[model samples]
Target: MTSLNPRLGLFRDQHVVRLAAILALLLIFFAIVKPKNFFGLATWQSMAIQFPEFGLMALGVMLAMVIGGIDLSVVGIANMTAIGSALLMLQIAPVGSDASTGYLALAAAIGLSLVIGALAGALNGILVAKVRIPAILVTLGTFELFTGIAVIVSGGKPTSGLPPQYAEVMASRLFGVIPMPLIIFIIGAVLVGLLMYKSAFGTKLYMLGSNETAAQFSGLKTTSLIIRTYMISGVLASLAGLVMLANYNSAKADYGSTYTLLAVLIVVLGGVNPNGGSGRLSGVILAVVVLQVLSSLLNTFPNISNFYRPLIWGGVLLLVIVVNQWGKNNNLARLFRWKGNAS
Candidate 1:
């Protein structure tokens, strides 16, 4: 274990460096390929607006992965939350309503969405921690459960006709430059960083992930920890749903269906081990940026259909997993050699 620590530390640093390099290279490539399109503020702004939709989901997924679990229900939670919020907004302030009424409706919708997200997340936690169902199975079940509820509530139709102020405020830029979604993403990431790095809860989470048995024996409230972790994930998903609602000016049960896959890809690409107990939020943030850049670069070619995006994403995901696994093996070999030399 002692010998492995230094190797893991070095790998973590190298992973960040690799992601940074990839981002820089993608930027240069895009700039050269479509200087007129890529060099413009509009292009960058569009990227900023789009990435946060899945980027926030990736953050939630990262938290689950860090605790040695996976939350497949993030996209479902997001859709359900958005659908509920949209319905509430329509009820409170239909189109052509007063601005004051619209604002009030917006606040109420946000509050309700968050509360719904929390309850949904709590249900997953209860099933996993209390009932001892595997996290993956529990989340998978809830994904369908939540999606079904969203469909029933929405009647398989998009929830539209939200107050204009909702989009005007949410989609608006600060000082005519920075996007609201980008700002929200930054704030969310920073808060997650603080929670993961600056608090006792973070330490306990890591310890639990590293060795649940040890955590249990040491008197850590493992059940509570798991529940809290999933709750945070749920909140993140709800937040992402709100962002999507603003962007699309509507909500639907099947919106961003591919986002669950993309979120997992981002988390894994960010260096969070699927096996658990190790990863960095910083790496996850960089991974989100890297993916957004790659996605923008792909847009440079009109011939590449958006339908192929899943194929591309899946290929990259497999490649990253293989590379990460190979690196681990190589590091273990070196550690063994060092032990042999010392003996």
Candidate 2:
């Protein structure tokens, strides 16, 4: 019963409540402005299919943010993994292929990409943990290095010529409605949520983020833990790359360049502290839904230039940061408590 209360308290958390309210308001506003498009199956499908890539990236961001770190190299890691997978697929099946050969190639590509992702993560982890450099600096440097390698490997062109089975496996709808990418995203979310809440590692991570000095004094293996956390982020980023590869039928150096900002924004808006002591995967998942819906809404207006999106996202991020700081200064928790009492 006591445990249940603590869990219930999360539902009553100010951030969760606020996100729910904003999501509802956004839906209502869009529905009112574009009734037909907002309420359509196509819109919903687009939202479901598209958000997962960003969602996956944001989830990786959330992990780093949880540990009081950031991974700006996610975009580079994702592109590199996708390119590697493409190269593997081509090598496996060559020019023309049978279904059996293509499936073999797909399996090999997935395995290879995951390994590459882990290795990429290990590199970031070592620089940050072993070398004791600040995470932001380490990741930023690696981001450029990874991107340069990807560009050199692919010669600045998208890798296309994939086995037909690659697209077939990724594009097929699960249960005739849900996109496979969405399903993959949900699975990742669930695993991460459990990792953050139900695991001892989660507790240690929170402690480390809250106060690194204290964590080290308490005899926690801070370095290894940071390494493992970044490794997880890398794997998730690679998964995003694989999904993007399938979605577009190609892999490019510049793919999802805007994603890095959007991902950090998602993590921040999802209520992860920049100083990084507290956060929840549940909140991050809701944030994903909200952003996806908002993104799809932007697409509904044909006259709205796609270029406006980053600007809008940037503006929203700035607002959220300001509001977040204000809320902290103003004791917004007390305000919520007061409002709850009045209600």
Candidate 3:
């Protein structure tokens, strides 16, 4: 019994650990419920392909949320970048271009799209930081603004007909099975992890979110940090846009509209404190996998419609919030004389 307690303690020590156990149980449950479907390679492949798009967006959301902010503009920024990239590629290589020319156009389009994303993010940063507006309000307005710009640019239609190269390379797997977007997401995760774990900026971000007043009094440049943080979110959203554009071969002003709320749900489920100043990139990544797998597993059942997924996501978010609220102070821990007593 004592040995079992120590092993159980390992699972209870961290939110990620607990979530991982839940994920493991969920996989096992799905496997038991539908042994044939759950074990199929196609199901796993589809889940892997879908994970990165939402995962990347959720990471952006996590960053903003960590600093006690929310970015409603991520969807808009993603669509706008996608629209811009498609339009640029069309002008550069057109539909009938040779493969080499198409690849060149693709390269140029990627660079231009990233720049557009950065500029858009910079606009978001300026509005939130220098303009002295709340992050929520600023991003909310930019959300519509960017989305509108995408629509106007695309004439309220999908931007398509990119160089053939774009589709070919995007579809091509790294080792003939792993999707390119998954690789991109891995690279992105490494970069984001370094940004958060190895820099003074990350420290300042946490401090600012923990207590802006104290950060200001400590001579930290709070406004600049806020701007930088939003910029990262904007850029990440743009990367997500690229992924969508590549996958669909078309960019629509309203593409992945579901992602906005879904990203929030992922961040919340990843154990990011909505109030701010605490979150783990690793947790968000794990959350992405769990949610994606759950989605795929649920998808195996014909009775569950796509419409209900959002409802389930919202319910999970509410449940987590309620659980956290109930146990946050952990009065019961003190009553039971737990080892780690609250200071």
Per lDDT, the best of the predicted structures is 1
Measured by C-alpha RMSD in angstroms, how accurate is candidate 1?
Answer: 4.3
Kindly give the stretch of ten consecutive residues in candidate 2 with the minimal lDDT sum: 1-10
Task: Estimate candidate 3's alpha-carbon lDDT, on a 0 to 1 scale.
Answer: 0.82
Candidate 3 to truth, TM: 0.91
Clashing pairs in 1: none
Q: What does the lDDT read for residue 292 in candidate 1?
A: 88
- Using TM-score as the yardstick, the better of models 2 and 3 is 2
By lDDT, the candidates rank as 1, 2, 3
Residue-pair clashes per candidate: 0, 0, 0
Across 305-326, the per-residue lDDT of candidate 3 in tens digits comes to: 9999889988988887777665
Name model 2 segments beyond 4 Å from true: 1-8, 331-343
Residue by residue across 1-343, what tens digits does model 1's lDDT show? 1111212464447667788888888888888888998879999999999989998889888888877888999999999999999999999998889999999999999999889988988899889899999999999999999999999999999999999989888899999999999998998898888888788787777777788899999899999999888998999999899999999999999999989889999998988888777777877888999988888887878899999999988998999998788677587578778999999
lDDT (10s digit) by residue, model 2, range 76-107: 99999999999999999977789999999999
For candidate 2, the per-residue lDDT at 241 reads 94
**lDDT of candidate model 2 versus the reference:** 0.87
